[model samples]
Target chain A: MSFLIGDGMTGGYGSADILHDCTIAVEKGEIAVIVGPNGAGKSTAMKAVFGMLPLRLGHVRLEGEDITALTPQARVAKGMAFVPQTQNVFTSLTVQENLEMGAYLRRDDIRGTMEQVFDLFPILGEKRRQPAGELSGGQRQQVAVGRALMTQPSVLMLDEPTAGVSPIVMDELFDRIIEVARTGIAILMVEQNARQALNIADRGYVLVQGENRYTDTGEALLANPDVRRSFLGG
Target chain B: MVDILNALVLFSNFVLIPGLAYGAQLALGALGVTLIYAVLRFSNFAHGDLMAFGTMATILVTWWFQSMGISFGVLPTALLALPFGIAIAAVMSLFMDRAVYSFYRKKRAAPVTFVIASVGVMFILNGVVRLIIGPDDQRFADGERFIVRARDFEAWSGLSEGLALRSTQAITLVVAILIVIALFWFLNRTRMGKAMRAYSDNEDLALLSGIDPARVVMVTWIIAAALATIAGVLYGLDKSFKPFTYFQLLLPIFAAAIVGGIGNPVGAIAGGFVIAFSEVTVTYAYKRFLGHLLPENLAPDGLVQLLSTDYKFAVSFVILVVVLLFRPTGLFRGKVI
Candidate 1:
């Protein structure tokens, strides 16, 4: 069994379903990437797994324990951290303050976790006192990811973490994400740069209109001629 | 030299001292307004009445204290009664939030809806304060009135004009400074305060981080109530307590908040002083002070005051309008209203 699973999920923002029987799962220390065309419900699948989307007809389980009814906040308490694609950082707050707020639920000392985040994103440490709003887009994304890591969550979820950054920053962020996964945390992220994302992904799911069209090992998915021709623009 | 010294004394006596005291009161009042705007994301029209309500509570307690022969000696007995007033105000604020504002908040109502709801609260609070305290002026200040008596100053300085500093004015400045310091410290250093700022900055992200919205809102109300109570008491001590005056004060208070940038605390303080000095300087009759400065022949006969004190609120209105027109985000780049 996967460490975390959103099995057969079906739901949407309202009556009209955005996700249909979508299944996404990630094992411990593995990176699972979700990618597809625009309006293909790729982000919806991630939201469903994170409990941000109300699942109408599916179950999510963490280590075989059902968590289908939990809220996003409650899921955070259960060791899941989500980095939103936009407005992810507290613009008015300093970078350090943003990290502190992420660890608000923890009673123990958060200094160590903050230090770890700084290690993961060293620029954040250098600009710790600067307000997150003052940073550039890529730096702001780093602050967002660093804030989520401060929670010391078992699973880290990102929604198109590299959506608007330059290609160089995107590669750097991907490298950082790989480093985070090496720390034995399950990483599930939606990516727009599908080729680069699959290059580092352990498993990849190709979503089409909220349904999984292809699920395979990252290397195998990259090599598949049909996936290359249709989705990867071969 | 004597003419210059007398003119300086006259300016300090009438304009500087009064402006400082008035500015301190407005700063405190505007701080409360700014905090609510920042965290709750609405302009609370009821804030002025809340101050009146808190002042009324303090006045009642002061009257009781006087009857019991309790006093602060050199300071007004109202100072001792302040905490009880603050507690009452805090409780009332929490109740108002829970009973009135929370419903709109739960509905995710628009900021305009919240503003209109606050107007309803303002009417209720205004009525309640008037009913309990009566519409008449209540002078609760009882202490050694003059920190620097005019006659004593004249004797000491040997000047035609004597600078008199009222104890209430001194206390107002002192207390206002202390409260501002404490508030800034709390906001910058404390954990709960950071949570409040984070919530104010980004509500969705704050929720995702597990910072409880209810707790932040409750704390914001409590702090705002405390500030309003303190400001009301100080202003009452400096002048006199009247429900109608406090109700009327809403204009200047809102003007101060808006002029300073609606949600910025530092801007509130700056805005308060700006409005105060502008009102005082514009309305002040420079007939006597000019006599000291200018040659006897050059000194004009008519009062040199540009505006009447009766139009003091208009100064704030003008400043508010000017600020909104030119820089809506305010002097400190606070959130635009």
Candidate 2:
């Protein structure tokens, strides 16, 4: 069993099921990337793992404890942080304030964690007083990740964090994710840049229509001829 | 020099002082409206009635205080009674939220649905206030009425025009400044305040960050209730407390909020002053002041008022329309209405 797993998850937003026995798992200090074609239910699978969608059948376990009944907020208290694809940062709030809001549930000191986040993204430290909305797309993404990291979660999940940024910024974000994973936080993210995401991923799950079509080490999935020709655009 | 001095004093007497007081009242009212719009995501049509309800509570308490012979010594008893009014208003507002707004919220209703629901709430609150206070005007203000009497000012300044400063006007300005400072501090410096801002900025992100929606909504209602109560009491003190008059005030208050940028607090204050000054200056008769400024022979003219006092509310309507047409987001770039 992995450290965190959504085993055999099956559900949808409405009556129509978006996932069918989909499974995803990640261990501590490793990067797990979910990548596939458009409408492959990549984001849906991630949403299921985060408890944003109800599961008709299956269970989510964190450290062997069933958390399927918990709300999304409760999962945050259990040290899971999710960064949405859009509207991730509080546009009206300053970057520092955005990070402060992220640590709202914590009763302990979060200044050290905030400082570490600033260290991770130096530009955010410089523009801490600026409103998150005023920052460029890449800088805003950094602020979003920094805000999520303020909670010091054991698992950090990103939903296409690099969606609109330039290629250079995407690489920078990927590097930051790898660094975050190195800090012993399990990194689970959905990525559109499949080849680059797989290059840095320790484990890769290729989802097709809400079900896992291939689950392997990142290198093996990248080397596989079928994955290359069909999904990765050989 | 004497002509200029008299003209200036006349302008100050009729426009500046009254405008400031009225602006303060409208700003406070609009601040409450803007807060609800920002956090709750709806235009609360019941705000005017909420003010009336709070003022009614204050008036009853003031009467009680007078019966008990309790006074604040040169301050209106309403000031002392204000906290009770605020508490009542807060309770009422919370009850309304739970009983009415929360259901629509749970249903994921559209903004228009929330607005129509608010209109229903408005009618109910309006009837409740009229029933308790009656349709007649109520005078609860009891204090030293004038801070600067016109006769004393004329004698002191040795000018033809006399300037009078009412105690209520001074009180309104002082109270308004203090409240604004405290509000800004709360919004910027406090943990829960920032959480509220975060929630207003992005509801999903705030929830994912573990900020409770119920707690935020509760706090917003409390603060808004306090603001509405204070604004109502102050306005009643400045003029008179008539339930109908308070209901009529909704137009100007909404104008202020929309002109300032619907969900922006700073914009509310700016919008308030803009509307108040426009209404005051446009309706003011400039005949005497112009006579002082011009030569004696050239003073043969009618009352030079641009608009009648009956058309005062129309000024707000015009400004609201112009703002909506040119910059729907408001002067400070607030959320588009």
Candidate 3:
């Protein structure tokens, strides 16, 4: 069974439906990547799972518990964290303060979790005292991810974490994400860099028009002629 | 040495001491304005009127306390009656928010709409205070008036100029500092304070992180009410309480809030002193101050005043205009409060 799953999500911003029978899931210790064209509801699917947008037709389950009716804060308490594509970090707060805010719900010790985050992104540790706004795009993304990690969640979701970063930074981020998955956390990520993302993803999902067009192992999706030509731009 | 000492005494009597007390009052008032702006995302035009209402409540309570033979010894009984004033103000503010501001908030109305609504509240509150307290000035301060008398100072220092330190001035300075320090501690060290800051920074993110917006708003109004009451009572103790006077004082209070950076607490305190110094120094007749520094021939006729005391509010106006024209975000550059 999947650790986290959004099975057959069907909803939109208002009256119109943007997603039609969309299903996505990630198992424990696996990295699942969602890749698609712009306006194809990539971020919307992520938002649905995070409880930002309500699903009209389907339920979201975290470890077999239905969380469809839960608020975002309730979801966070149930070991779920989501990092948006933009404005994901608290800009005015220092990197440490941002991390502290991420652990707002935790009543236990967060220092160890913070140390682990620092280990994942050493540059963040170096610039811990600096405001998150002062960091470069790559570093800011690290802070955003680091903040999410402070909650010590079993599942971590990223919406285009490497959207504006350099190619080198993107590779490094994927490597860190893999390391995080190795520690038994489920990762659900939406990426614009589909080819590179598929290189590291345990499972790859190709969403077109807010519906599942392709689903397979990352290596299989990368090797498929149709996916390579149509979706990955040959 | 003697000349310099005389100049120092004259400056302290006219500008330093009074400015310090007035600055404390304005700082507290501006702190309320800044907090409401930070949390509710609007400039609270009704803050000054809230102060008047709160102070009016405290004065009535003090009168009751006085008739009942209760006192704080050398301190004014108003000091002891402060919590009642704060409680009344908090209740009124929350009621106002529910009746007027909450509807617009639910509509996701613009900041300008809130400002207009607060103006409506301001008028209503003004009318209420005037109706209850009457339009005339009322002095409720009852205590040992001075810590050091002017005659005592002259005798002790043997200086040409005398300096008197009023009990109200000492209390104002001390109480303001304590409140500011406590506020800083609350915001920096407490979980709730950090949550409020998070809400101010990004509302959606704050919600995702589990910060309750209602709790933050309630705390903001409570703190603002308490600060406003203390500031108003202190000002009334130093000067006198007149409902219209607080309405007029709003200009300088806003000027201070804007100058220090509207959403920043520390900036509000600094801005308060800036406005106070500007008003006091500009309106003060500095002939005595200049006479101590310059020779008899150099000390020319006429008061060396930049502006008349009657136009003291004008000083704040010009400063506000200049600050807004140049740096609308204020000295601290908050997120457009």
Candidate 4:
């Protein structure tokens, strides 16, 4: 069974729907990537799943249990975390404090979780006392991801993690994401780099103007001539 | 030598001691204002009236305690009633947040809208305080008036001119120091304080981190209320409790907040002193003080007051304008956003 599901999301800021009956699922221990052109509502779909945007005609489920009405904080408590595309880190807080905030809903001792996050992103550990704002772009992204991971989320959603990083850093971020997936966390990420993102995705979704045009295994979508021509820059 | 002694005494009475006390008061008040601005992302123009309300509560409680025959000896009876004032003010703040401010917050209203709403709140609170207190000045400061009278200091030092340090003024300085130390510690050491800073730094990121915005707003109001009460009560104790006096103090407080770099606590404190000293020194008549140092014919005919005493608040206003014109961020370098 899929660990997280967004079934038939249809909503936007106002009257017009940015997402129209959109469905996306992330299985346990897999990287599910969503790629689309600008104005395609990729981020909107993520927000709907995270409960940041109102759902006009859809429901989201985690492990087959409906949680469409839960607030974002409630979603965090329910073992689901979302990292937005920009300004995702508390810039004034130290690296450690940023991670500590991620575990705000948890009452237990988070030392173990902190150590685990540090293990996953060693640069964060090295600069734990430094403010998150002082870090390089790639390192800040790592801090953002590490902050979300502190909740020990079953499904970790990232919105365009590599949107503003160098090519080498983007490759490094993808490697860390693959490593996170190895720890049995369902990873749902939206990306602008369609081809590279699909290459590492266990499942790839191609969206156009808020509707899913194709859904397939990563390799299958890469080989699809139409996807290659339109999205993959043939 | 005589003129220099007189100037020093004048400086001590009007500038050094009073400036510190007033700066401390403004600092505390501005700290709360900055917190709300930082966390809530708006300038609460109602902050002055809120301080008035807190002081009004303190005045009522002090009167109650005094009537009950409870006293703190040489110390002002108002200090003993401070906690009660703080509690009531906190509750009032919570109510304001829950009833008025929260609606705007939920609507995600523009900061300017909040500013206007705060102005409305200011009027409501002003009316409420006036209705209860009768708009009259209440002298709640009882017991010894001065720690050291000028005559006594002159007798001791044989300087012909001596400082008159009021008991309330001394208390104001000591209490202000303690409050500042305690506030800094809370903001730096406590989890909720850090959460506040985080929220101020980045609101969306804070929400994403599972920090409840409502709880943070509640906490901000509570702290602001407490700080406002303390500052207002102390100001009243040092001077006199007149509701309108607090309303006037708002301009200077805002000047301090802006000068200290809005949303920056340390900046607020610095800005407070800056405004205080500027007000004192600019309007201060230096003729007498300079007379003793200069030759007989060189003695100036003017009072040497740069501006009249009535326009002291104007001094702060001028400094604020200059700061804004030159460095809009503030002298202490605060966030412009």
Clashes of 1: 0
At residue B187, candidate 4 shows an lDDT of 78
RMSD of each: 0.9, 0.9, 1.6, 2.0
Clashing pairs in 2: none
Q: Is the docking of candidate 3 incorrect, acceptable, medium or high quality?
A: medium
Clashing pairs in 3: none
A119 Cα displacement, candidate 3 (Å):
2.8
- Model 4 alpha-carbon drift over 4 Å, by segment: B1-10
Reference-based lDDT, each prediction: 0.93, 0.95, 0.92, 0.88
Candidate 2 lDDT (Cα, 0 to 1): 0.95
Residue-by-residue lDDT tens digits, candidate 3, B113-220: 999999999999999999998999999888899999989999999998999999999999999999999999998778888888878887887776767788898899
Q: Write the per-residue lDDT of candidate 3 for residues A1-234, one digit (tens) a residue.
A: 688999999999899989898999999999999998888898899899988887889989999999999988899999998888888888877888888889888889988999999999999999999988999999999998998888888999999999999999998999999999999999999999999999999999999999999999999999999999998999
TM match of model 4 to true structure:
0.95
**Superposed model 3: Cα runs more than 4 Å off:** none
Error of model 1, residue A192, in angstroms: 0.7
Model 4, residue A18: displacement in angstroms? 2.7
Task: Provide chain B's TM-score, model 2.
Answer: 0.99
In the range A73-132, model 1's lDDT, one tens digit per residue, is: 999999999999999999989999999999999999999999999988999999999999
**Compared with the true structure, what per-residue lDDT tens digits does model 2 show for residues B1-337?**
9999999999999999999999999999999999999999999999999999999999999999999999989988999999999999999999999999999999989888999999999999999998888989888889799999999999999998999999999999999999999999999999999999999989999999999999999999999999999999999999999998998899999999999998999999999999999999999999999999999999948999999999999999999999999999999888753
Which should have the higher TM-score, number 2 or number 3?
2
Measured over the true interface residues after superposition, the C-alpha RMSD of each candidate is: 0.5, 0.4, 1.1, 1.1
